[model samples]
Target: MIITRAKEYCIKILSSSNCKKLPFHNLSHTQEVVEHAALIAKETSIDSEETEPIIIAAWFHDTGHSKTYFGHEEVSKELANEYLTSVGYDTKKIKIVLSCIDATKMPQHPSNLHAKVLCDADLFHIGTELFFCKKLLLRREWELEKIKTYSDKEWHKINLAFLEKHKFKTDYGQTVLEDMKLKNLEKVKTILSFY
Candidate 1:
């Protein structure tokens, strides 16, 4: 499948990168995104035709992450185009691919079906048991980047506030993923008391 090929390429990219600068953004994260993207594709009632584009988008979504520039979504799309074009992925499909990558940008609000699917897939980790673990890694990444660091108390407050602020936008997300989402959030809430 196209996604499988794309994911393989992403793996190659991750394997080739220096672990120091791109510690959190690695092959495991790309694999998780591909898995979740496929899950969302299955659960979302999106046509099979939409599947490859979404999956390919997910695969290449973070490929540019280790580059000198911090925000790598655009470069990821460019990378996708470069690789996919050589393999005969249509140019038109590349536009949708670009849209899917952009959908994952922070403060995300999907305005199209492709965007919605990609956004849902990106946030799919929120419903998983490892949601808290991923958040911790995110915190660590932020610390490494010198973006911000919080005390234990402050971190707990920040995590809880962020979780509380998030609401699922799609019916598929609301129905199937929402319960797990709440459970994940509650786990954080429970941990906060210990801090």
Candidate 2:
């Protein structure tokens, strides 16, 4: 399957030396997004045909981090297009995968169901038990990049605002993950209060 081939390609790209600096956007993160995409696809009863692009998008969405972090989604989309075309994947399906990758960009806006699933899957950790740990890794990445160091309290407020502004676009995300996300928000709030 094209999706299977895409996954293998994604793994190879992510494991290459170019991705060594990506502490947070590593292979594990891509795998997690793939798992989340599958779960959301199943819960939403998305057919296999529709699910293919979503899964492929999930794998390639963060692969751009291998090259650069800023504007990574555009890079990811370009890379996805190059890879899918090289593999002789359907041009229409490649377009769908590109759209899904674009939907994963920050302040996500998904125009279709598959994009919605990809968006939610890409951010599934925001509601999971691993949220804090994953966030710490992101913080570390920022620090390493000298992007802007934040105090623990400052990070709490930033995280609080982010969580407050973020909304799960899909029914499955809202129903299954929204409450947990709210809890995570509250936890951040509580930490901020203590600070």
TM-score top scorer: 2
Separate clash counts for every candidate: 0, 0
Off by over 4 Å in 2: none
Question: Cα lDDT of all candidates, in order?
Answer: 0.78, 0.90
Per-residue error (Å), model 1, residue 31: 0.7
Q: Which tens-of-lDDT digit does each residue in 18-66 have in candidate 2? A: 6666678889889999999999999999999889989999999998887
Task: Show the lowest summed lDDT stretch of 10 residues, model 1.
Answer: 17-26
Count: clashes, candidate 2: 0
